[model samples]
Each structure stands twice: as structure tokens, then as C-alpha cells.
Target: MTTTRRPGAYHCGIDAAMDVIGGKWKVLILWALDERARRFGELRRLLPGITEKVLASHLRELETAKIVRREEFEEVPPRVEYSLTPRGVALNEALAPLGAWGREHVIGGTAVTPGG
Candidate 1:
């Protein structure tokens, strides 16, 4: 599908959406944080193959997009947690069926259900 660019449109929804949450890692990050907020270390562990730097970058992008919110607690050792914003939660809801379909048909080697 080709999308037309409008003049002076710095924030087209489609383009902005793709920019915010594009790439494999970002969706996985969103998925991991869907149910509950997690610390940086927790996210790293949940997504085993991702490097710390890459995860940090993705998190920053998501936070900037307003999809993810980061909360920091000051103490002797600072604590940080990441959670989905309302927008992120809505996107997650939209993607849920796609994820389920991928798991069932694409990964499990079964035929995709109609309309999925």
C-alpha cells in the first residue's frame, strides 16, 4: 500500500505510527509491557536476544511517541519502570488478533483462519 505525503505534514498518523513502533523489537517490547510495567532489566530478560543499547533506544522512541511512559523513582539506587500509555494499549488491542494468528498459523504451521 502506497501512502501519499501531505505538505507540511510532520505527523501523519500512518507515518507517525510506523515511525514510533516500527521494527521487530518494538512490538515485542510493547507486548511485554502490555500487562504490567517492568524495569529495564526485566525487559531485557523477557526479550533475551535484545542488547541493552537497542532496548534503550527502542524504549526512548516509544516514550517519545507517547506510547510508553517511563517512571523513575529516586532512592539510593534509582528505579525506573515502563508501561503502555492509553494509546499503546489501544494499539496492543488492535494487534492482538494478528499476534494470535501469527502464532497459530505462521509459527504453528497451520492454515490461517478466514478473516484473521
Candidate 2:
């Protein structure tokens, strides 16, 4: 898989991080796998509005980045599952405060409309 995320080219840690997860779906994918391993169909159900192509691409990128692990089981019909790696767990944990802030300021708390 060819990517522009070269080594030593990032200006900061966040820059490098964003290069791996710089999309609308990657972070959501990470969050979905935070609890337990899930099959492709399960992940699709968990995250609504994500196209199959985008989900497949993000899964590939995350796997390449070592943030997600994919396992294939040998059974009647090939079974595959996706789960978060340790690094992914750490990334999710780091984003906890941001989630809390969003919940407080945007979701459960006051609804701040723009240009109000």
C-alpha cells in the first residue's frame, strides 16, 4: 500500500498521528473496536453512514499503522475480525477528554448554534 506518511517528515506528534487517522471514519472505526473484536458486517452496523469502500480503506490504513489488527479464522466460511491494538487503545484513551468536552459542550449540555 503506497502512502505519503513518510518517516521523519512530520512537524509534530499530532501531525504524524493525523497522517494515520486524518479522516471522518478512521477515528470512529477506532472507537468501534475499542471494546471488542468485530466482524466487517458488525462494524458496518455499529457505524452508520460509512461506505464499504471507505471502511475497507480505513481498515487497511489503520492496520498498516499498527493501530488495528485483523484476524482471519479458518472455518466453514472464512471468518475475519478486527480489534484495536495496544497503540490504538492508547490513542482512544488520549481522546477521552476530547469526547468528554464534546459531550459537555455540544451533546448533553447546551446546544450552541453558530452565529447565535
Given candidate 1, what's the lDDT at residue 11?
65
Candidate 1 versus the native: TM-score? 0.78
Q: Which stretches of candidate 1 lie over 4 Å from their true place?
A: 1-16, 111-116
- Model 1, 39-90: lDDT tens digits are 9999999999999989998888788777899999987688999999999999
Residue 6 lDDT, candidate 1, scale 0-100: 43
Model 2 scores what on Cα lDDT? 0.89
Angstrom error of the Cα, residue 54, model 1: value is 0.6
Which candidate leads the pack in TM-score? 2
Give each prediction's root-mean-square deviation over alpha carbons.
6.2, 2.0
